[model samples]
Target: MIVDANVRFEALSALLGTKITSLSGGNPWKAAPALSVDDFFIQLILNKKTSYAEEFFIDEKEFFDPGYDFDFTNLSDSAACMRGNEPYVRPKGWYRMALKVRGKYLDGDAWLGTNGWRSYSVPGEWPVSYHGTGLEGARGIIRTHYKAGDGQQFGRGIYSTPKLNEAEKYCKTFKSKFTGKTYKVIMQNRIKPEKRQIIGNYWLIPVLAGTSAEEEKRIAESSIRPYGVLIKEM
Candidate 1:
């Protein structure tokens, strides 16, 4: 007896208490009744009654429900990090996410004064002040004391001497390391003492390069939505 693929799929969906449209439309199946979709399919296989339809249906338990149990606390922490308005603690879990290659080197160079002296700023174009992106904003704070000809003070300069050839080379290397590279990242939210305040947020500090393709794919699929300075890849 030949059964229509769609008809069989709909029967499976009904048995699992999920919408037939959801199954046919390729959407993630909602939590079904006590009997999971996988269990239902497995029962059919054991009964030896689904042999005719088995050829068209592949057991896709993983696709239907990736078994990773997400920690609600961790998800809350992630949400808090994105908000940037309160102090949050990092929950221990690796989240999969993507980051777009916006530019090379988090820091940028800026001419400090009319005397041709250049200074290093967290974001070269923007003033190195407190930004509201939680931990990232706190990390951008620079600690340095600069003096001019007479009696003056400023932030740290980019180079002590006028020789910028070596500095340019370093910049190129830094750019090469991150630019045009894959955007996939596995990261965790962290908290650290910044000056006087303890700030927390997801950082790119310990970027995880997964050992295998499966691991990488899992990370990419499960990561949190990128926010703040991290742009989502289109």
Candidate 2:
């Protein structure tokens, strides 16, 4: 599960519009009305018609919750401090899109199975972490699972951070021709407490020092799950 240290993360800004065009038989975004950066990313991820695709669909089921709002409750003290101290990061930021996907070995999960996707913040489950990535990376994760080789800093596992500022450091910038502005995406994930190892600021899903390749992959697929997508305009 190890990746070469020389590998570089390519910026996907150049391909965003092209990909959308192919999927939609043209650059539908251009013909559509003006939208904020938040709505743009949400539309891309949902992969639905822009005219009436405001609701977020989890596992093909429509969830009634709509609109974005700042969540001030249920946040830990450290979360508050990081958001408060950071200049660009807002403590009262809203999650415009909710992405709750069930991964392998999660059918029988105690927390998720009992309370369902709505119980994302319930205690005694996986803790929250943020993984900053480009639009391509976000697409891959939402469509499938995380590729172990995508991250190699801490030995080939999904990389994330508890602090938003730290995660923001890894966020790749994309200049949108449609909006004439730049945007960044951060995946709000839940890391299994028992399967993850914290080394300084990075949180890695698998302990891959002496494990087989298959084992490392399994731990990664089951341990980390993305529940939300957070985007910021830079």
TM-score winner: 2
- The runs of at least 3 residues in candidate 1 whose Cα sits more than 4 Å from the true structure, single-residue gaps closed, are 1-202, 205-210, 226-234
Q: How well is each residue in 115-164 modelled by candidate 1, as lDDT tens digits?
A: 12123222212111111111111212111222334555433211111111
Look at candidate 2 and give me any clashing residue pairs. Answer: none
Clash count, candidate 1: 1
Q: In order, what lDDT does every prediction score? A: 0.23, 0.43
- Model 1 scores a C-alpha lDDT of 0.23
Query: In candidate 2, where is summed lDDT lowest over 10 consecutive residues?
Result: 1-10
Q: Write the per-residue lDDT of candidate 2 for residues 125-194, one digit (tens) a residue.
A: 5666776654455422222234345553344445566767767765656655555556565666566667
Model 2 ranges with Cα > 4 A deviation: 1-95, 102-105, 108-121, 134-154, 207-216
